[model samples]
Target: MTQQHGKKIMIVTAPANGKRFCGETNYYEQLLTAVANSGGKGYVFPLDKNPMDRKGFYWDAPNRRWVAAFCPIPDIVYNRYPFKIRENKLACKRFFQWLDDQHIPCFNTAFFDKLTIATLLKNDAVLSAHAPLTEQLRSLEQLRRRLKKYPVVFLKDIHGAQGRGIWKVVRKGKSYQLHSQRKVFPSLTFPALSCLLQPVIKQRTLLIQQGIRSLKTADGVYDFRVLMMKEKKHWQCIGTGIRLAAHGGFTTHVKYGGKAASTNAALLRPPQAVVAFIGRHVGRLLDASYPHIREFSMDMVMDRNRQLWIVDINSKPMSFDENIIQQKRIRKLVNIFLKQGV
Candidate 1:
C-alpha cells in the first residue's frame, strides 16, 4: 500500500472559479489530502491552461488559495474535464495529444460513445444478454421500425449527458406524443413519426433504445450507479448506490431531481451478489478494451423479470464519496499511479 514518495498527481478538471479548480471542489480537497497522506502531492490542474507549456496553478495548502506555478509533468494525469468541453474544444484535443506525445499516463482520456459501447456489448457473448436493444438513429424510417416493436422508445443525443436532450416517445391512438427533459416544448403530438423526428434527427446523431420497464416503488423508478476503480493491476468496485428518479422523470441523473442512497438489496428482485458479479465483469471487459481507463461508472437496472441490463457507461465518472476515498482501494489506485506513470 505504499506509494513512491513525492510522486506528483495532476487532476485535470473544469474551472470552478475564474482562477482555481473548483468544479468538484470538496472531492478534490479530499483527494489531495489523501494523496498527501499517501506520500504523493496532488494538484488541481485546470483544462483551460496549455498542456504543452507544462505550467499550471496548484492549490496552496497554507494560504488556502490557488497559486500559479511551474508544474512538472505529473506522474499521472487524471482527466475529469466536463464532457462538453472535452468534446467540442480544439485545445482539449491538442492537450490530450500533448499528453500522448509526452508519454504521460492519463485515465479516462476521452468520453465513450453510447452507440459504440452498446454495439460492443451486444456483440459480446457473455454480456449480450445484459445489453438493451440499441441502434443509431440515422433516419426517421429507422425510428419508426423500432417504435413498432417497443411500446416506449427513447431518442438520446449520442454525446448528451445529465439527462439533457433526451426524449420519451409514447404511442397515442393514431398519433405519437413526445416528452422532453430540457426543451421548452413540454409535449408535442405528431401525426406521423417522420414528421416529429425529422427535426430532431437533423440536429445530431441520436441513439434509439427500447426503454426497459424499470423497477419501481410508490416513490419512483430506481436504478444503481456502480463505480469501479483500478486497484493496482485489477479493477475493484469502490461504490454502489441506489438512485431514484424524481416523480415523472425518466432518468435517474441527479441533475434531474434524483436522489441517491446506499444500495438496498431488498429494493432489487435479484440478490445483490448477482448484481455485483455482473458489474465486476462489465468493468473488466471495459478496462481490457480501453487500457488507459483507471475508473468508470455504469448505470444499471433490474427489470420485473429479474433480468439485469446495463443502460450506460461513463468513462469520466463523478467524484467518489469520502467513504470510498478513505477505503483501502485509494491506496491501490495511488500505487498504480506511481507505477504506471502513463
Candidate 2:
C-alpha cells in the first residue's frame, strides 16, 4: 500500500482531563501514532476547545476555532467523544446531531441516535432477528409475569452504558430477589437492588430482557466483544476480544470491574457457526444502522445449544487496542480521507 502524501485525518474527542472523564485510554493517542507512522498528519480537536476559535486552514489553538487545513474538508472526521447516555445526555445528543448535520464524510451517523435505536427495537423483525428479545415494563406485576417465563431477566436503562444501571432479577421460592441472576452466580441484598432500580426508573425508559446464560470461566462469566469494521466495500473482522467479569459477577462490562483478554483465550472460544452467524447479522445491522456508519463493536453470546445472540450493539465503543491486529483497517480509514484529494 503506497502512502498518500497530503491527505490528513481529523479527530474530534472529549477532553482527557475533564471531570466526567470517560474511563478508558484514549484511542486517539494510538491513532496519532498510526498516522505518524503512515506518513500522514493527524489533527486532533479536543471537545473542550471552542469551535468559534479559528485561524487559517488549520485550527488556531490559540484562538480556539477550526482552521481550514490546506487540505479538502478533512478527508475524514472521527467522532469519539465520551458520553454517558444516562448522564449529561441532552448535551451529548446535541453535539452528535451537530456533527451529523455538518454533512462531512463521517461514521456512526445520527441514524442510531438515542430515540431511533429504541424505536427500531420495537419492530418484530428487527427484534426477532437482531436484538435480544426485550420489553419495557413499569410495574412489579408486569415484571413478575415476565420473570415466570424466563429464568433470568435483566433490567436496563434504554440509554445506559458502561453497565452502570443494570439489574438481574430472578425468582427464589415464594419471593423474588434481585441477584446476579445469570446461572445463579450470587445475590445482592434486597435493599441494594431497590437502590439500583429506583434511579433507573426515574430515567423513564426502563427495559427488561431475557438473559442469555453466559459462558463460565475461571475468572468469572464472560462474553465476546467482536470488532466489526467497514473497509472500502467490504465488512471485515478486524479483531475480537473478551471481557470477563470478576468472580461471581453477572455483567461483564469493562467499566464495572471487568478485565480484557484476547478473543482466542482458553474460555473465550465459541463454535464456528456462532461466530459466523454474528458476523452475518451484525454486518446487516450495521448496514441498516447507516449507509455511512463505518465501525462499531458488537457484544455477543453463545447459548448452551450454540445459538448466538447479540446482547448489545455499541456505535462508539472503547477502541484502545483493536487497531493492532488489523492495522490495515486503520490504514483503509485513513485512505478514505486521502482519496478525497485534499
Candidate 3:
C-alpha cells in the first residue's frame, strides 16, 4: 500500500492492444518506465470495462520492458488513446464516465478537432493575429473560392494526425493540381476536381485552409513541434524542435520519415515570442475551454512573409528524438501525476 502511494498514474488506452506497436508490445511503457525512473508509478489501462487490477500493464525495469504485473488503482488517469479512430469511439466516452463516477481525475480525454481548433484561434483577439482562414470543406465551389484568395489551399481531415488524410492543392491558371501520397496529379478541371473530392468529402470531415508557404531557408523546411505543460495554473514551454520535412514531403511527421533535425544549422528558428504566443497565450485560451487538456504539442510553420501559423495541436503528441525535451517533458508529467494524485 505504501509503495503505490503518491505514484499510481494510469494511462487509458484503446483495445487495439499493444500488438499494433511496431516494436514494443506497449508503447506507453516508455512513459511508465519514465515514471518509474522519476520515482512515480505509471501503468497502461486498456479501454475495456474490466476491473482486474493487473489486467493493464506496468513497467518492468528488471526485464527492461513492459510486463503484465499488478497495477494498483491509480490516483489519476491520463488518456493516451493512441489513434484518433480509436479515441473517437463511444467506449472512450463511457470510460471517462466511469472514471468520473469513481471521482478519478483524468486529463486529455479527447482529441481537438481541426475545425474547432481553427475557430478557437481565429476568434481569440491575440491569437487571431497569426490565424489563417479555415472553413469546412463542402463543395467544389468552396475549393475554387479558396484558391482565388490564396495560391495554395489544403484539405485537412478534421480529426486526422501525423499528416494522414491530407490533400494539397495549388492554383495554376483556371485549373488546379492535387498533391498527395508524394506524387503530383495532373491538373484537373473544376468539374473533374469536384468529382474526385466528392467521395473523400463524404468519407471524412476535412477542413479547407489557406496554405502558408514556408519561409525560404537553405536549412530545409521547418515544421516546429512546441511541447507545453501546465505548472500549476500557468503553462511552461518544454522545447521547440524542427520537424524536418522530407524534400517535397507533404507532411513533417516522423512516420513519413521526417524527424527532428539533429543539427541546429538552421537558417531560422522559432522566436521566443512565437514560442510564448503558443505556449503562454494560446495555451491559456485553449485550457480555459478544454480544461482537461493538461499538455499539448503544437505543430507550427513560419511562412515566407515571417507569419507563423498553427497547423496542428495534439493532446497525445508522438515522441521526439530530442532527449533533453523528452526528459523535461517526462519529469514535468511525473510531477503533475504526483501532485494531482490522491
Candidate 4:
C-alpha cells in the first residue's frame, strides 16, 4: 500500500436500509468509478452508521470511518446526508463536528446546527424574485382571504417531498377545489391539512405558498431539474433534465407516477435561453446566500406568461442514472478537487 499516488475519496449516504432513495447512491458509485478510472481510490459510508457500533465493520472498499482511522482524513467528502437534525436529533451531528474539529474538509458545515433546508429559503429576500410569498395559514378564513390575492394557493407540509401532502387550490365558481393526482381530491380536506400543519406551525415552521402555474407538457405538468456543482472558481451547470408527471398528473415525481425525461424533448419543451438564464441566476444566488453548500438541485417552473418561479431548492439533489452520466463534467469536478487539495 506504499507505492501509489492516488487520492482517497468518500461519499456520505443515508442509512444503508433507509426507506427513502437519495441522489448520493448513484453519485457515489459513479464518482468512485470515475476516480478509479483516473487512478484514485473511492469509498462510501452511510452517514448514520457509527464505526463504534460494530467493533470491526467490514467495508469491502475504503470507508469514511476507516479513512478516518488509517489516513486520519480524506482528500474530500461529498456530503449527501438528508435526515433532519432536531433538538431531539443530535446523534450523528457530534460525529461530523468531531471530524470538523480535526479539520476535515467537508463540503457543507454543520455550523447552522439543526436548521432545515426550508429555513434557508424561508427568507424571501434571499432570492425574492424567485421565491413566492409563503405565509402561515391560520384558519379557513385566512386561506379564503389568500385566494383573493392568489387564485391558486399551495398548502404544503413544512416537511414534504416527492409531492406528498402538497395540495393546490384553485377557484371554481363560488368555491375552490384542491388539486392533486391530476384531479380534485374532494376540494379541501381541512382536517388532513390541519393535522399536518398544526405540529409544525406550533414550532412556527409550517408554511403556505401562493402557487404558480407551471409549464405543462402533452404528458402532463413538467419542471426543470438544474444540476449545480461547485467548481474552483464558481458553481457550474453540469446538465439539466425535465421531470414530467405521468399522464394527467400534477406532480412530476416518479414515485407519484411521474417519469424523467430529457429537457430538449417535445414533452418538456423549454427555451434554451430561459434554461440558461435560470441556471446562471440559481448559481449566483446560491453562492451569495449559502456559500458553504457546494452542490444543489433547483426545481423551477415557467408560467403561461413565461415568468419563472422557483418551487424547490434542495441542498442535496438526486443524481442522474448511469444512462445520463456527463463524463466530462465529472472529470472536471475530480480535477478541481484534487488541484485545490480539497
Query: Pick by lDDT: which candidate is best?
Result: 3
- What tens-digit string does per-residue lDDT give for candidate 3 at 41-93? 77776655454433666768678765665567667887777677766567666
Candidate 4 segments exceeding 4 Å error:
1-4, 18-24, 49-72, 85-88, 109-127, 138-140, 179-184, 187-205, 262-264, 321-329
RMSD over all Cα atoms, model 1? 3.1
**C-alpha RMSD by candidate, in order:** 3.1, 5.8, 2.7, 5.2
On residues 260-286, what C-alpha lDDT tens digit does candidate 1 reach at each position?
A: 755343576446577667767777777
Model 1 regions more than 4 Å off: 1-3, 16-19, 61-64, 84-89, 182-196, 262-266, 320-332, 339-342
- Between prediction 2 and prediction 4, which has the larger TM-score? 4
Instruction: List ranges where model 3 is wrong by over 4 Å.
Output: 1-6, 17-27, 49-54, 216-220
lDDT per residue, candidate 4, 142-204, as tens digits?
Answer: 776787788788776655555765767776555566675456654445555445445645654
Q: How much is 226 displaced in model 2, in angstroms? A: 0.5
Q: What's model 3's overall lDDT?
A: 0.74
How far residue 59's Cα lies from its native spot in candidate 3, in Å, is 1.2
Could you tell me every candidate's TM-score relative to the true structure? 0.88, 0.75, 0.90, 0.77
In terms of lDDT, the poorest run of 10 residues in model 2 is 52-61
Clashes of each: 2, 9, 0, 0
How many clashes does the backbone of model 1 have?
Answer: 2
Q: What is the lDDT of candidate 1?
A: 0.73
RMSD of 4: 5.2
In candidate 3, how many Å is residue 257 off?
2.8
